[model samples]
Target chain A: MVLDPPLPRPMIGRLVVIGLGLIGSSILRAADARRLAEVSVAYDAEPAVRARVAELGIADEVASSPAEAVKDADIIVLCVPVGAMGAVAQAIAPHVKPGAIVSDVGSVKGAVLNALRTHLPSGVHVVPAHPVAGTEYSGPDAGFATLFKNRWCIVTPPEGADAEAVQAVTALWTALGANVETMTAEHHDLVLAITSHVPHLIAYNIVGTAADLEKVTSSEVIKYSAGGFRDFTRIAASDPTMWRDVFLNNREAVIEVLGRFTEDLIALQRAIRWEQGETLFDLFTRTRAIRRSIIEIGQETAAPDFGRERG
Target chain B: MVLDPPLPRPMIGRLVVIGLGLIGSSILRAADARRLAEVSVAYDAEPAVRARVAELGIADEVASSPAEAVKDADIIVLCVPVGAMGAVAQAIAPHVKPGAIVSDVGSVKGAVLNALRTHLPSGVHVVPAHPVAGTEYSGPDAGFATLFKNRWCIVTPPEGADAEAVQAVTALWTALGANVETMTAEHHDLVLAITSHVPHLIAYNIVGTAADLEKVTSSEVIKYSAGGFRDFTRIAASDPTMWRDVFLNNREAVIEVLGRFTEDLIALQRAIRWEQGETLFDLFTRTRAIRRSIIEIGQETAAPDFGRERG
Candidate 1:
């Protein structure tokens, strides 16, 4: 049996990518690889990023502004921070072509959906999405065509959203090498709060602690990081503004999960202080099973030591 | 110049290893691969582990007891947990010949040193070391010869120890593919408390929290772990018994560091609650440099996401 080579651009009409950071740049590069659109244009507020995008030829055209980028586009993916969503929608609304499907790759879906609904033109089909894929690295140079391959892209189309628009957005993400699923913005925010936001918060807090220690020098932490602290640093090193926005926008969910995390931590602290070996053992043993489940579900590698050997 | 393929066990002495778990079995396999010892013997509390070691030909002989394994050996390595150090030392004291170097690979040095000094016979050079390398897996089946390659081994020799014995112990680890450095037992504990013990405690605590959540399902935690939580689960999945022993044996140091960690975490929590975006950004940006230094020092790869790919 034989299969035809996937076309570069599976979707028709213009695809305007706003913001040329890691996610936005990757989207353009991937679509260009397969010629996924009849026309591709991108805009980044940062002139340096815009110039770099022009240099890389990542998109068919680099627009001078968001308004210009989506002038005749069938889809406009606002890959800006959650805080920037409303402003970006406002900037592009006047120029967004009627019947265009508007989406985003923000982490906080509920807040982003609110912003899109508030500022995007009534005719624009609002389809807020969260692509749960990224590296700590950011910027145009940090992105690659395969960044979204095998990653999950959750599309949250509010009630009464255009079904055709939602389908078009899902199909676009699928073609970009992602697995797409639909859920409400509220559920997406809650799920991500526990899965991503709080974990990142914990990592950031710990790394900060390690750095600010008085007796234990920072040099010592870096030298012996292979012990465990190094892994936390990777997540903690993620884009600061982006994460800050996530925590602020999803405050209720983040606070709720963080409260649970604090309670569990206090109990473990008590166990350690009181020498309750059995309690620690039970908890540790249970957590090990979670790691196996993650590996089995294809979210992580089963390789020992995270397969961290130089490759 | 040719290096003679680094003789499989270049040291001229019989190596007796007690406890055949991840670290123990790795030591045996590495020594055998390089011929770093003349003849190697090992003993484990578990008969199944002993049988497997013999089956794999990991050592010259699998002894029935620690006393028997160290009877005629010039060097005896205690690879058991920190809590088991004292009893194992007592068992081998009468059998360990004078001038024989007694060493251990426990993570907590101060406690292990105290155990060695009290239980082992006089004139037996005592060396307590930690090869800051391991995977989540344990047991003989999880061992590998290259486990210590490019890893750091902290050799904490007691004050006024035999120079010759210390040199022999250092040579053994260096030949087995670890970079060896010497420090006092007290200092090693303090450093490891921050670098390893507390980090593991946090990982275990977070995984436990995520699992015990009422609102967030365990299944969701596993499915979406790639966002950030998966890395913590990796560290948390480490052998529970080994970590429990570490925390107990290094109680003072662990408590001290854990205290600082709690304080810092509380401050971050406050900042988050108050919407102090600058505070969060400052911490997130600073942590990124630590990751860079770890990668630059060769302890970790600069690869995005710890180089965790489909493999």
Candidate 2:
């Protein structure tokens, strides 16, 4: 069967994806696959990544410097770690062409926007974006063209910025197979703290706890991980440098949600000690609905558990 | 491209999958797909479950009683929760044909073996197994043939058990595409507690806490769950009955691991509160290695965070 091609978006005259890591590379792949841009260029700090892009032919051009990559590029996307955003912004500050829309794919929005906003030159539109998609893997080698298909790409427009630029970025993401949503930077940070940041931290924390256990327990953790803990291990296995930046950059939001999390955990501990089965069951049942919603929203594939995809 | 047809197994064999559910049904799918048995039967106390098995055509025959299911069966495997093992064992105690090999897919082995050893009649060999697999989904409809494929299936046979019976079960799982390992029931429980039970409890606690937050934060949990908490939610959404049974059956191991986890968590929490970057980064880096090991062991698929395998 001949497959229909992805829809075209003529509004995006030029598109450039910077960083070329998992998120950036995925965006490059998706945008290129969908033909969303007239010209798609990828830039990465690492020479190997640039060599990889050349090998895969994922983009029309590969640049080593942020200035050279963003030059004459209508849309520039920053996909570096949250902590690295400031330096990237500073380096590219003087080089950014007028009217060029600058956006990012950072997990933490408020801090990133704050960092980049202070570094940007006037007339260069800055929109902070958080694509609610990713895998446990990292680097250019671990990316695919279909990674963003049907995932969310949130665009947080700064106060009094160009509406047309925000819309254009949103349009570009939509054409790349992402559902676009606009949110306030503060609100985006708060929401992500609970959903993404806190969870990663907790996964990392628990895995650390397991690793630090007595030798008998540590070995047991690895051997019998199939039950549930192994899932956390997979998430916790994410890049340490990236995650450290995430925690340090998104400090307030992470700490706020974490404070609430520790309290709730202690309560559950109390309930378990008291053998309050009804409380446990009630919470378990309520949480089940959220999972159902995730499936219904088409964010998840139509497999109970994951057999439909894995098998 | 044409698919390769599987090699046929020896016929004239009878198989009974006791307590048909996610794992049991998957085993049936694998066995049936491979033509591993001439006749396969299933037993479940829930009439609805039995009817569903018939609806899915998972077995050649559906039996109302454990005794009926095991009658004339060469292999009888239990797939019930850990807590239900004793009752199931006693119910099938009087009806098992001589020389029939009995096995189980319970999570906590030590207690389950203890229960079965007390109830099963002599001459019926008990070979307890725990396939380090499963999804959050439950019931017969949730099963798939490839659930065990490329996953670990640990077999904990008692000392001096019949060699042929153990090998038969091992061969059966091997045919189903599982890598099998043998360990004592006591060791299996301890390992699972650190790897599966404690992590699950932590996920449930954090998700529950996030859910119980003041309205604003609660909504944020759902909206931004793309960050990290959503991973926890997936694990937290597992069947409450199975989890409850897990805690009760593996009380000693779970409690011991929980103690260690709490201590480590407290230390981390102190570090976070005191703004100790070195301490947090050190622990975080150490946990990353475990994640690498999981991938190295081939337990994980090569997908980025939420975008890897669809669940």
Candidate 3:
């Protein structure tokens, strides 16, 4: 394994990561790999997950409870599902030390920021962040130190939030090799609703629709999937509980963006029915430029089929 | 480069491929690499494409016209887009050798079979096939000899199509490392509408929807594409003319499948609006199983994010 270069100074004094799943375990691994924090601790509501994390040896300590995990942390990141953000914040609020920066890796920002502010004590700081990177796999073993490397991490700090705390959170992500951008919680929700949440919902919905087809057998769908359907299945295979919570928590933006998607799909359907070849061709050509832009920006691979191995 | 094992005997005495684009060029390359045909000839309406095919030296001879290409060939495969299939078939009809097998790689089989039957001479056997594989990129330079390796190629021969001709087409694809399955033309259209055509329509529609969003800037979508939107963009970037033809020729099945997709998406939207977590979770779980089946059948990769290179 390649070693990361040592940092000039540790970014955080004591770091606590709650919820030792994909994102949480990745933070612990990255912190240890880069020595981003002087001391790194971990906790998960599931006793089994904590035990497995201890076995992975990614954290300096795997705390048995949330209170113990945050008692000495200078920065605490809640990495649980969005629906559980409120309860996880409330559970650790009482023991969180003053001047600590509390952050999260939730997909939705507005609801998560509200949850953090509502439950946490006033003296502590809350700087919510979302690393827009992941694989279909989940759980502790599914993560690696470079999971966030070269990916975007949007930090949505509420207005009038502590500047120093925001800087510390931004520095942590930068040290982990992510490009950091700051925005309002509400704006972050709207942006992600288009870029991530609605896209995922569409993938899940199509796969579900394919599965329920009476004339088409599931075996046939599976067999002929490489034709294009398989790509959607990869994202549809992501953690169901996390995605469920994302939709429930980011309800407004998701519904609004989904409305746009439905409207566009209806127009495309009409074009098909009316045999409007020029209309279909124009939209198809326009969409290709966006893909080119994405590849040029390094957000996506230029390789075909995401560089999937060919036989 | 690794060499393909030589075939016991050439599958066809002479093979002519019309429309030297991605699928056509790939056929030429695979035929030469595996020695599937004793002599391979090529033709394209565009002079530039024919010149490129000659420069690549993939075909034994690059004929200037469809008539010249099929005049002496034993098996002729039309590789043009679905919209151009009838015209290409008619152009080559008078010159096609008697007792030769006329086949195609069009995505939709029923309409193509009809086009071939309507235009071609009675002595030549007509069989329509679709190799369910491709990259988003198009044209001669985008193809490789192994494009069909381990992928499924569905053969839809018209009723009472010559048995010997059907076997020859099957043998040619098998020699190029494809697993061949036989079905009726109508069934092939329906199966592909769900597994390939409709999925591409959804991908194209979503990308179009995202582009038209005033709330989310294109730059933001491009920069944060790693958050799931990029996958749809890959398919959305496919050749516009090719995809438009697919929806047009397969209109009946595509409209039926797309109707199902829209219905399911609306239900998902309602579930999100009502915060129906269990409903979302259940569908997500079911979709994951389809992905697993596809991987287990070797139609998809088991590696995370299609084994895209990491930083």
Candidate 4:
């Protein structure tokens, strides 16, 4: 019955997951499977999602309220959208254990850091984290136990964050199958602004443009999307509330990066207009090298066609 | 083989594929495997690709040159890059079989149509086709027989073209597992500009922007690419020569579409700058609907996470 060796459980005695969408439910599933905590509790604003999590038996307890869920928890992970982080943290702050490590899974850490500093209780330690992985799908059903496998989780701890709390949170992510790296909140926001936020804005804009084109019907766009356009649709399909908050909260970094991207795109437009083949060729070649490196190291290049090929 | 049911072969005596790249070799493999043609012949400008196609036995014969490849071929396809299409047609024109049907797998049809009309010899029917399917990978070894399965192939026959040639080409695509539709060359270019060309440009431009960020190193960009940026890199990694030619040949349409996309992007960028959450949210939600439609009809939504799950 017990053929495999027992895994070393992390020191988190009670792990509370607030907001039961993709990231929240995934954390619960991973913590349960990996035995990262002694017991797990969950709370989602949506009753339907709470019911689904209960039906799936993803957590040991499905709480009626965030306060009830984190009443005795040693670690509380806020899993709500970035816009809801401040309120969620404020609501659960009063119930958290005196030395509880409060953390969040927000894409933009600088804003979350400010939110945590403003809303969370003084005694509860705040260590903001961002797991740089997702699918277009959302809700509890979209979560899987291994979603974090081989993914990066950047922990953006404040300058005066508790060292023990930060280390413990890092161990928890490691136990849940993520590689953790520590950085400042400002640096994290700048890096993510370039990597995730602006790219998402561009994708959302293109899909919007394609849909609104009078000359090309939306059906035609859908039919022929397999050629390059569909690739953007995947990321564009990410939860709107989450992205909306990301842009609002990380306004400065996003605007800064968006400005740069706009400049590059305009230059490209000029080259295309003037039939500058060599310029286009050079950029395409350089970008191809970047993808090659991403594929080789990140292993994102495993399946050709991004695995869209059904046959 | 003896126990298997005999397959009904599609018409056409010889299908000659010029340029053994992803689409070219894929056609040869699909044709040979489906018995769509009695025999398939191929030639590539690159000697190594020719040798590999011959060694892989993907084609019945691998000729030394495009001219040799199309001699007596019933269907001759110029599969070279779009910029090279005119020259490829001119090179193979002298040896083309009398009354033979010539076609292509270019992304932009109007330019290809013009190239065909100008360079192809008389008595050789030119029916430019764009099979709206591909993986990011290029080269002979990257092709598979099932690449065209369930994909769409747009056949843009010129005015007053031979009816039998169009029907035979449609049948060939159907046999190789594609849904065929016919449209004018002008309409094809416009639709493809929105669907494929502009999207490729955005992908290329963003990847370049990410790489050139002075604050975030390239390694960081690649490592954290799973956050929306990785999707762009997949399309950006496509063949440089092919994409450069696509931009050059389809410059006016592409520039026109890019102007619209840039306008939309700047609007979104302004929304972000001014903290227009509702505008961003509405656009993001609408785009999600577009992706759902693409998933429903195109059936490209298989395997969540765009098949980037590392389990």
Candidate 5:
């Protein structure tokens, strides 16, 4: 079971990651660990986060401002929330290098692509990516170097975008141990709506419903959560502002998928009401195959209860 | 961090487990590991499962028939589905010894309590319990001795039941490494409906919805499931027959909780449709505290992603 260390791949001359949150700090840490870039810089709007990132020493240099962070960088990654993509692009536009590739790690690609295109300078390329990986915890302290390892990193380059820029972005994610996929922004949004966005919305919605129950005490819900409700709580515990922006920016796609979800749920509710055992059994049986498929593709763990330690 | 071994307590002279599924097999394994019962016997309706249990060697004896299983047992815990509880109870009623205790590990307490009380002999005491623990995988091979370790085992004794019989059932669960809680069958049903039943229904419902999407391919859903959909798939992958019986038996509580869930979801849908960022943020923030409480109380793991090994 002995394994060789990953060889350092010095792809970019200078890499700057703005917004030192979970994904941001993770990118910095992974870049340092893998030597994906020659020099790495970090910046965050919050002075406290920038100081914390500096203290953690994941980045070679902690920049004081968005403009300063991107001024001499070959690639600038905007890891801020989806809603803040435009403002961060605008803030860094004036100082960004002419040939620098401007990228983002937003969940919603369509809005983020439009935001980056409208704000960044003409010579600067825009490449938006959504890494299909995360945890419930957020912030710099919650991140680690292997967050993207063995995870999917989806790149949604705008139509008629530069190929070299796209390739560079893809290679960076690849060197950082991610399986990269490229798709249109619209397609990416629709796919993520069913796969990620709507799931998170429903999880948050269910947790809220459970918290406000009058017949059941909150303590009871918390105590017996191992049954199933605890899983939703984990997803619902994700960063609030980031998820808020995801729902806000991707409203159309989220609403469309959610409508379908409610329609299917209503049918299930009717089946439960009518005591249709066969219908429930059939749906329950079919869902197991999807879980198997995800595990087979190495997208999820096959361990029971996610390999959680039992006392 | 050295810990002492759990002290063995011989609580029951002869224990018979009638279903050999996940919960049933785990009970036998835990009983054997802790020495909670002097002799543990097992029987499953499915011949294949009974043979597998014998091969696993978790029980002292694998009985061939219902009569043979419970003929001389001091405590018989029926681990069959809620709908099958009565039939299993009735099958062994004529052969059961007088003054023996009959208990069950069914998920729905109220219906199971009713079924056991109606089918068991007059002198046999009925005490139904539901351990609020399990994995998505089921059957004999999917279970382990520590499945119930540090988990909650809720006991719902029939009204005016024998005091010694209730104590015996509670002591058995405690000796098997579970925290025992006593409550009325009605309250247990209500609590579990929110915590387990409805959560499972919605998980099954959402996975079905995602599978039926036209714009998003099933392969895409499986590839990008790590966002949040994968968590739901785990719950949805639970045993179909067991869950079908749970929804059918706990129809009232599940429907009531599901109604609240839909109402809350509609409000959330409206908020998203109207771009209410603050509304989403407020609820998302509040849900994080419940997750913290569940972890604090030891019902859930504090590790990120349930401590799944990262590559």
Candidate 6:
């Protein structure tokens, strides 16, 4: 007994998920499970990943290369790291069918679009998508069908771009159970710079710092990491290639936000050094509100332990 | 039903958990559920909290003052913030039953002991305990009986301290399923300053900085928080009063570790600004091992989405 009317039948054609890593493989599985596409093809450079593609049964077809993956695909998703997007775009541009739509699952959309704009053949639609969903794990085997369920997927379509292509990509992600939002690439970079890149970089930096500490033994760090450092380590443990490309491609926005972060951190350092309990308390209390808002938006879980137990 | 022989139970007459906050209430619940103690009493300074204490039906007895709570208790646990330990100890010391045990749930052992040592009666044994378990939430209702399960509890007993009292507390925490470890006060402060205090302070600082960014709106921060800052906000949102006391009490250790953290953060900041991909990748990769160790120790759970599913 359904309370609401049934959802409309989704509109999607042949879809391709590039660089079959955690996100890529997950999207493939998610699309197949949701029946979002007639055919889904996955591609990766590494032979092992490609071999695992056959083993996992994620995609209907496994392509030899980026070009092969998008040869006849209507919706081509560049699921590789930001650093590899340029080369993959170059390789696939020549083979992209006319009227075909191209999108990506890259973290930084602005850079990805910029890299692909020159190589992409005319009349082919390009919509940069960032499925704001991932895990600490990587590689093909790490993916699951439920990865994109109820997550946010930001679609950055170029100004005055093909409306149909945008609609097709949006529908594809929507069927995969993601709430899609469209924004300008520049705005997306700036927003993501604060929300994703800077936070990840900070986590990486803190964990790196902890690792390099001379006074504290690594064993001690691991044993006593039930504290705040463990959370950073979790974030810091994400795929290195993905993060490297993220920082490289989103340089300007990352730097700008990082400047703000550094200044704020220094101010906090001063407060701690001076024993300013009021400032610390005020900041701590204020951040709690932000967490609550995230929970409200349904971007983060409301569980007390953040659903770690189920995971 | 019991495959193994029942573990020997220590004879702990009555345990009073002062301040029905996250730690206190949780300890009371866990102790009572495990039948680790004959009786469990809870106390909070605020009448509202005391009234709610009765409402929760967790404690065998609820009291508004430390003196009333510890009056006839065999073990009086000061579960209040580190800053308030002195006052709570003073009020309860005179009323604590002769030969009773006095302990704490504060992070910093040396400071808590120093703060409350002078206030205790000659016969009352002081054994400082720091159970390394918590969430961002606080207060009586936030506590759960399983909060201390599988967590680490560091106990620091003074020289010539009552062996029986220390053993009883250790046994009780063990019964509650916490892995108990004993260390000197100085060592405990140093370890915690790095593992908990410094990391928490850094998290609070970073989140505050993110909140203050003018170019990036709070809405943007919350919307895109899935990348990494979300984890920091969770850690930073921990009780302000409790953390303030932690930093204030463990000044030297916190300062020393904080200095190391700042130096490391600066180096990473430089690397990011310079777009040094190798350095970032190398540093980021090394942190993964620590995360694996944490998962192995059962301190953290590995997740595919790391709690980004709700949104």
Measured against the true two-chain complex, the DockQ scores of the candidates, in the order shown, are 0.60, 0.40, 0.78, 0.62, 0.74, 0.56
Residue A171 of model 6, lDDT score: 83
TM-score of each: 0.96, 0.86, 0.99, 0.96, 0.98, 0.93
Give candidate 4's error at residue B133 in angstroms.
Answer: 0.8
**Whose lDDT is greatest here?**
3
Poorest 10 consecutive residues by lDDT, candidate 2 chain B: B1-10
Judge candidate 2 at residue B267 and give its lDDT.
72
Q: What is the TM-score of chain B in candidate 1?
A: 0.96
Docking class of 5: medium
Which candidate has the highest DockQ of all? 3
Give Cα-based local distance difference scores for all models. Answer: 0.85, 0.78, 0.91, 0.87, 0.90, 0.80
Over the stretch B1-311, how does candidate 2's per-residue lDDT look in tens digits?
11124545544389899888889999888888777888989889999999999999979999987778988888888999888999999999998888888899888898888898899887888898889888888889878888887778889998888899899889878887888989888877877877788888888877777777664455445655655666677777788877777776777777777778777766766676666777777877788787667656666544455233431
Cα shift from native, residue A281, model 2 (Å): 2.9
Candidate 3: list runs displaced more than 4 Å: A1-4, B1-4
Q: Report the poorest 10 consecutive residues by lDDT, candidate 5 chain B.
A: B1-10
* Model 3 alpha-carbon miss at residue B151, Å: 0.6
lDDT of 3 by residue, B202-222 (tens): 899888888889988988888
Q: Clashing pairs in model 3?
A: none
Model 2, A1-311: lDDT tens digits are 11126554545666878787888888887777777777888888889989998898989898878888888889999999988999999988888889999999998888899998899988899988888877777898777776666677888998897989888888878776777888898887777777777788778888887776665555556655666777787668776667777877777777887888777766666666666667767777777777666556665543544432352
The regions of model 5 sitting more than 4 angstroms off are A1-9, B1-9
* TM-score top scorer: 3
Task: Please give the ranking of all candidate structures by TM-score, highest first, separated by commas.
Answer: 3, 5, 4, 1, 6, 2
Which residue pairs clash in candidate 6?
A: A298-B310, A298-B311, A299-B311
The order of the candidates by DockQ, greatest first, is 3, 5, 4, 1, 6, 2
Tens digit of lDDT per residue, candidate 4, span A1-311?
11112267556789999999989999998888777778899999999999999999999999999878999898989999999998988888778878989998999888888888898878989999999888888899998877787889999989888999999889888877888988888888899998899989889999999988898898888899888898888889999999999999999998888888889989998888888889999999999898889878863865787765454
Residue pairs clashing, model 5: none
Would candidate 3 be rated incorrect, acceptable, medium or high by CAPRI criteria? medium
DockQ winner between 3 and 5, please give it.
3
